[model samples]
Target: MNIWEYIYSPIIIFIASYILLRFAGKKAVSEMNSFDLLFIVVLGTIVSEPLVDKGIPSALSYGLVFTLVYILFSILTLNNKLRWLLITTPTVLVRNGDIDEKGLRKARITTDELLGTLREKGYATVKDIEMATMENMGKVSVIPKSYARPVQPSDLNLFPGAAFIPIPLVMNGQILMHNMKYLKLDEEWLKRELTRQNIAFDKLDDITLASYNAKGQLDIDTDNDEGHNHNPYMYKPGNTN
Candidate 1:
């Protein structure tokens, strides 16, 4: 309630949280497994107690001590002998397009779960994947078979020139002035391009999204065809019109 408690406590808590999170490593936060999730929940409860409870004397000091202890243990776990005690190694779920049933059982993941993860990653069947690894953080990383991979423009010996990142000029009927400025483009140039495409200045509201690349490729999507179904593979290199 006091000014010191309000400001000081939050600053201390934030610093402690940041240190603890950094010590835990990136995977602990980015791709958290069941154990990592539990660790975070417990850590949150412990860290938040001192801030919430005003009756406790030396609360900030206690928090700092606890956080430092956790960081020390995290550093100790970096040793080869102690690393396995803290972190799980990645499990090979599929190898050479064959399912590793034993590995799956050890990881406590079902075949259906593995299949579902593969499908989410664009692999429809296990045979399409050369290797599927379940990372320590519980994320499925896949290596597709060479035959299943799509051909790149380079494979066809086509020099399409350097591709520039498309900058969005408009989104949901609003002009993105910041993106225009970043691309060193002005409103007059955009207006001219829109007018050339038969889009009137006042009719800009009809456009849902509009982007342009350095190669003069302008992509425009309008709100008029929300229900339109287009083939995704139609734009592929060898696809017929």
Candidate 2:
């Protein structure tokens, strides 16, 4: 086989692959319905055929044709009249805190699975749920009874501080100097804060993780912390490599 075949075949396949990826990847795997998943699985096999047989031109053509068909089918699903042909409608699994056995059987989901899904949604038991439905994407949507739901801050007329994303300032017993500089923090300030936390400045290597938030808070985890161990960093901060 000529070496040029390697470069030529890949470039042809890549153009076809990009179209499939660009359009078909709009939804995450967890969000794909049965038809969508099947289409993707079949299209993937068609795209890979070229790699196995070196049938580059024909494989690319079939791959692109199927991709366009999938896209057209997807667009048709947007219309109410055509949606029924494309996707399965949601099934009600629970109604008014009572399990709908028939609905569960229709959805092919066992009672145990329904209870587990409800638990994951933060409901301890079905008694608090007004409705639970199995969506087309295979995820459960749980709605709690209004009276049984937890109260929100709005209900108490209280405003709390906005949550801030925690920035990593240290990891694996080494300071992330870039993040510290981003936060306008210096080594002296970090040492002082560690000292205030009763951690010796000389024992920085004992720390495995540290993060700071905009709420003027410093959180630190040492090697002794659960699920962490004392592993020294291979390279110190400020290394270009």
Candidate 3:
């Protein structure tokens, strides 16, 4: 109701919410089931009531007290023995290519859901996985069998140059001046390159997208030709491949 109450109440409530979330554990919020979602909705309504209702003078004080109690209990859950009692541990859903039916039942995850997740990760069958863990956060992490894993570039002693994230230099015929500056490129340099590519400066208005990276050639697309075939090996000494 007063200035001090308006200021301190929100700060106290924010601290309380943070402490409560910390106690709830990361999984409780991230992998929220129906119960967790309901708890959060109820908690929000309860905490916010005082701020909206002019008649509730004691609500703010009560919220602060409740927050303190929550903080104390949260600290107690830090002990390893007590933590297990409060929080769900990661469940081993698959081990050595065998599905753990008991673990799936305990986690309340269906066989269909497990198979779907495995398929999403490109594993067609459980036998392809050496280990699969259902993390407390409800994410499935799979370790493929060594034979099933794809070979890395490093395994062949290949020294591919450093990777560069492509930067968009132009979109919808408009030059991205900020990106050009970030890439330490000037308008003159871009215009010169465009001219070399036979992209007339006057016809830049027809261009839709243009992007470049350190290791690759500049790419350009134009709105004028929706079905234009761009040659990959089109040669430009310094401007393109």
The numbered model that scores best in lDDT is 2
Better of 1 and 2 by TM-score: 2
Model 1: per-residue Cα lDDT over 57-169, one tens digit each: 45445545655665566576679998787778889999999999988998899999999999899989999889999887778899999888888787889879776778889
1 versus 2: better lDDT goes to: 2
Per-model C-alpha lDDT, please? 0.78, 0.83, 0.75
Candidate 2 per-residue lDDT over residues 1-241, each given as its tens digit = 6999888777777777877768665752447898788877987789878878988778877877887787788888899999998889999999998999999999998989888888788988998999999899988998899977889887899888887889998788888999999989999999888888988878878888889967666798887643333335434356532
Q: Estimate candidate 3's alpha-carbon lDDT, on a 0 to 1 scale.
A: 0.75
Pairs that clash in candidate 1? none
Candidate 3, TM-score vs. the true structure? Answer: 0.61
Q: Which scores higher on TM-score, 2 or 3?
A: 2
- Cα RMSD to native, each candidate? 7.5, 8.1, 8.9
Q: What TM-score does candidate 2 reach?
A: 0.64
* Tens-digit per-residue lDDT, 160-225, candidate 3: 988777788988888999999887889788888788778987777888888986854568888764
Instruction: Give the runs in model 2 whose Cα sits over 4 Å from its true position.
Output: 1-23, 26-28, 71-85, 110-113, 119-125, 154-157, 173-207, 224-241
Clashing pairs in 2: none
